[model samples]
Target: MDTDVIICGAGAAGLTLAVDLARRHIRFLLIDKAAGPFAGSRGKGIQPRSQEVFEDLGVIDAIVASGGEYPVQRHYTEDGTTVDEPVVVRSEPTAAEPYRIPLLVPQFLTERRLRERLTELGHIPRYGRELTGFAQDADGVTAEIAGPGGEQTVRARYLIGADGGSSTVRKALGIGFPGRTLGVRAVVADVLAEGVTADAWHRWGDGTAAQVSLCPLYGTEMFQLQGPLPFDVEVDLSAAGLTALVRERTGRDDLAIHAVSWASAFEMNARLADTYRQGRVFLAGDAAHCHPPTGGQGLNTGVQDAYNLGWKLAGVLGGAPDALLDSYEAERRPIAEDVLGLSTRLLEAARNRDHRRGREVGQLDLGYPDSPLSLASPGHDKGVRPGDRAPDAPVTGAGGLPTRLFTLFRGPHWTLLGHGVDRASAPAPRTGLRVHTIGARGDILDPGSHVRDGYGLASGRWVLVRPDGYVAAVLDTAGLPAAEAFLDSVGVRPPL
Candidate 1:
């Protein structure tokens, strides 16, 4: 095989997966049809769960640096009256949840941060390359790709489609993308403009009528323009067309559009693929699911999808059972289904002029409770359960330095966190797994009782965290045997 995996897009999803594979020392090819990274602030909200995923992928610092909090939204009526509201209800940060509020970073900046992380790991996405078609067999896949240099055929153990909603890989595989297009239509653009306050997201009309909205994008001088388009009207994506629409809607001769950087027609679509996997090829992000932009779920969901698949791919490529790969679609497809419903509801609410966004949009509460991989202990099903996001807590590492559970889970490794357990009672070292004992006399000291409170575990309990930051199993006193069995079932091998 030429490589272990071939990823066919360089958006948030593909870039995330590439960074993950690179960190794992996995051979992979990352390519994008575009000549360079995305240039728009299409999906700007980095939900809390995705923040944790970025932390593990080693790009959270850059993401946090490049993004800011969502600004208050100011809506204007036809009578020149205005009302103000926060974009999203803010949540206070706790020891377990450090990132509570959503961060407003442009999609382009997010992609750049992931790309920077990929480069640091000695990999770069091949630009100007398009996946024209591919054929997969029992062992691997052979892909036909078109690029600036010409056409080339490449072989890989697996193919991943992260190529956006209209995915070529999904189409070629004969997978069904079934969904309805919502009645909402708009023309979105990124523009350098004047006469707009940078502090608030300005809206021209109430939600009951056609609205023109301009949101100040963080880390850039441009604002993202969203103007309603008539259902039957042909969208004019030209700079003049967008400028005219903005002026016409806002009724402001003072507001000037100096430059149009990027523009596209926005149609709210709620779609989900019939299946996330077909033989040797898998779909993730927009390839597997599409959502309305209301809840800011599209980009964050897609980023997490790549996070879920990356580790599974690494495990399978390292000689795990072929069946281990099936869990990807099973675990993520259901998530997409639920997210589709959520974003659809949020879209409806927006149409009704209910602009209140709650903590649900933060995506911190999403998990795989019913997943086949989630094994809950019989009576220990209280605090953090299997398939739940593993919460972080304050801890003291060697030298009495302040640390966090997230710090131990930062790298590309499974974390075995034994709360209230001593160092002598910790589990033996395993390949690709880090064991941390958090107690008074443990390897890492949790004097604050944060771990106990966060995990809800006493002296004889333990938790096994997946590489993707989900709790795989919560164990009781006799946790070792069950944990070993769970690991074996998932094909975790002993160190050589």
Candidate 2:
């Protein structure tokens, strides 16, 4: 095999997965049909969850430094009536890691950042390489690629189709992409304009006839206009057409289209593959599922797919149980399906002509509930319950080490954090579990803090945190014996 994994597509999902695998010392070949990095900003928002993933990958700072800040978003009726108060959605309190709200960096920039990081790790995505076809068996998968030089054969332990919606790999694999094409088509344009506030995402709703959302891009007076066209009106989306729409909608005839970087018509669709894994070839990102861009979730969800699959792929390749790979589809498929359903609902709400309801659903932070991962310790009361993202908390010890629970969580390792347990006095020779002890004077509720408070973790209780920053097991002092047994069941050895 030329590599451990062959990732087809250099978009956000593919690049992120490659970088993550590289970090874990997994060999992979990442290919894309494009000549090089993208030039335009296609999808331009990074949700909180994605920011956390970026931090784990050690690239969040670079993204923040290169990207512009877009913190406020507002919705208004066509007559210029404010439908809702300007919502401050994207705010991160930490300077070292500031990307809580969805950042306004363009998709091209996001890919560039990921690529740069990948390069730093001594891996570069092979551009102008398209997957012609692929076949998988029990041992490995074989792929045919058409590159600038010509056709070539590449073999890998596994293959991932991160290709876009019209995926050739999916077609070659005979997988069905089930979904409905929307009746409405939206025109999107990225340009620079003066006299426009560069902070908020301004949306003007035309009661379902049409809608326009203007978002600012940093470093210049550039903005992105996304809106639906009239059902009955058929106009070519030339520079003149887009300018006319801006003038008629914003009442600003002077809104110059500095440069129509990229213009395309897109439709909202709700689609998902019936299966995420097919033998040794697995599908992810748009190849697995695609949804409307209404909630700004397309890129975020794809990046998350990489995060969920990267570690498992590395584990299996590194000699972990093959069953671990099954969890990739088990876990991420449902998330993508849910995101598809959510985006569909959001698109329908926007299409409903009810401005208030549309705005409400659009801004709602709909997350996955009822996950077994959210289980809490018995009789625990701190908000750091199970299945939820482990919150960062600040803690100060008697010795004033000035540590944080999240800082201790940096890794590819499962961490066991105890609030008051003395590390030196506790059991020695702990293997597979990185244990850290925090004394009093820690603030767990602060947004900047990595540790959450309500897990019934007292002076002697232990909190088991996963590599992805979710609580896997919580152990009261009395339940230590049972907790050790649980750890063994989960394929982890307890402290000796």
Candidate 3:
């Protein structure tokens, strides 16, 4: 085959999978129909779990440095009076939850950073490449692409559709995107405007009439404009039309829209694919599921899908069980369904003036406890369990270097965290495996008992972290019988 994987669409999901696969040295071809990088500030919120994923992929610093925190949204009354003082709730970063707040980076900038990282890894997305058709067999998949050079056919072991809401791959695979769209529509545009405060997201009008919002995009002169459209009317999508709409909706002609950069219409919809995988073809991101952008779950959930699927793909391609691939849909589809419900509820709440978000919006609690991959031994509870995120904790490493649990789990290898477990009989390092001890004869040091306390780890406690950073198994044995069984199920043979 030409490559191990073929990723369609260069958006957040495809780019994330490309980055992960490139890091693991898995051959993949990333393609997109767009002429160049996306140019909008849509999908601006990067949740904490996504931040952790970026850190593992070695792109968190770029993402953080490129964006700023989301400002409080300031709503105004009809008479130009501020509705209420805006207060943004912030959760402090702790040893257990390192990224407590969401970061606001424009989706375009986010894609640029991911593309740059992929370039650094020696793979670039083929711009203007469109997958016209595809077919799969027991051996592999063959896809036809229309590119700058002309039509071409490519072969791969597997094909992925990350193209967006109307995914060609999903359609070709005959997967149903069964959901209803919100009858109301919203007009969105990136504009250069004046006489507006950049400190907070400014809003005008009430839900009864028309509502308009102008939020400053971090590190850019443009603001993302969202205003309600008529329920049964078609509005012009021009600079003059947008300016007129802004004035008409906000009733603030004093605030002028100088220019428009990019504009698109947002008709909210909540849809999930019938299944995430079929034969050698799979769906991800908006291709697999699309949701209202109320809780900022669209991009984050898509990135999480790629994060969940990438390692499984890598594992299976590297001699792991084909059943390992089955867990991708099993683990991700349910999370997508739950997220769809969440975003839909948030959309309704916003429509009815109940707009507030908390830990739920951060997506830190999203896990796969029901996944077949999760195996927990009896009698060891209290903190994280199998299928939960492996929380980060402070620790001291070899040469007395200060580190965190995430620091150890940063690479493309399974991590065996031995907490208060004797290292006298610790398993030796094997292919795709790493071992570290905390507070048990000191292979890795836990000076403040952070790891032990964070994990609720008692003496003889051990936890196995999967390559994608989810807890696989936790037990009281250093021999890791439960872990071994889990690994063997996935066809990953770790040395005893």
TM-scores of the models, in the given order? 0.97, 0.84, 0.97
| C-alpha lDDT of residue 68 in model 3 | 88
Tens-digit lDDT string for candidate 2 (1-496)? 3889999999999998998898878889999998887766777867767877788888888887777656455776556566544333334455323335556688877888899999999999999998888888889998899998889999899999998888777888889888887677787777765556766767765444556777787644577878887555676566677777877776666665556776767776788988888888888888888878766778888888888788778767755567767767777777787777777776776676432222222222333234443334776666555555565556554554665556667666667776666565443444556766655433222233343343445566677776666676566666666656555544455443
- Alpha-carbon deviation at 104 in model 3, angstroms: 1.3
lDDT of 1 by residue, 388-457 (tens): 8899888899568999989888877888888766567655666877888776667788888898888888
> Model 2, stretches more than 4 Å misplaced?
71-84, 87-100, 194-205, 230-235, 248-251, 352-386, 397-399, 422-433, 440-454, 477-496
**Tens-digit lDDT string for candidate 3 (1-496):** 3889999999999999999999999999999998988888779889889999999999999999898888887888766578654323678999999998888888988999999999999999999999999889998999999999998999999999999998989998898899998776888788888878788888886565478889898878888898767666777777778778888877777777888878887688999999999999999999999988888899999999999899888888877878888999999999999999999988887787656677888888989898888885678868788888998988887677888889889978888888776786566456787888777466688888887788887778888898888888888774476577677666567555
Predicted structure 1: lDDT: 0.87
Best by lDDT: 1
Candidate 3: minimum summed lDDT over ten consecutive residues — where? 80-89
Worst 10 residues of 2 by lDDT: 355-364
Q: To one decimal, what is the Cα RMSD in angstroms of model 3 from the true structure?
A: 1.6
lDDT of each: 0.87, 0.70, 0.85
CA error at residue 219 for candidate 2, angstroms = 3.7
2 against 3, candidate with superior TM-score: 3
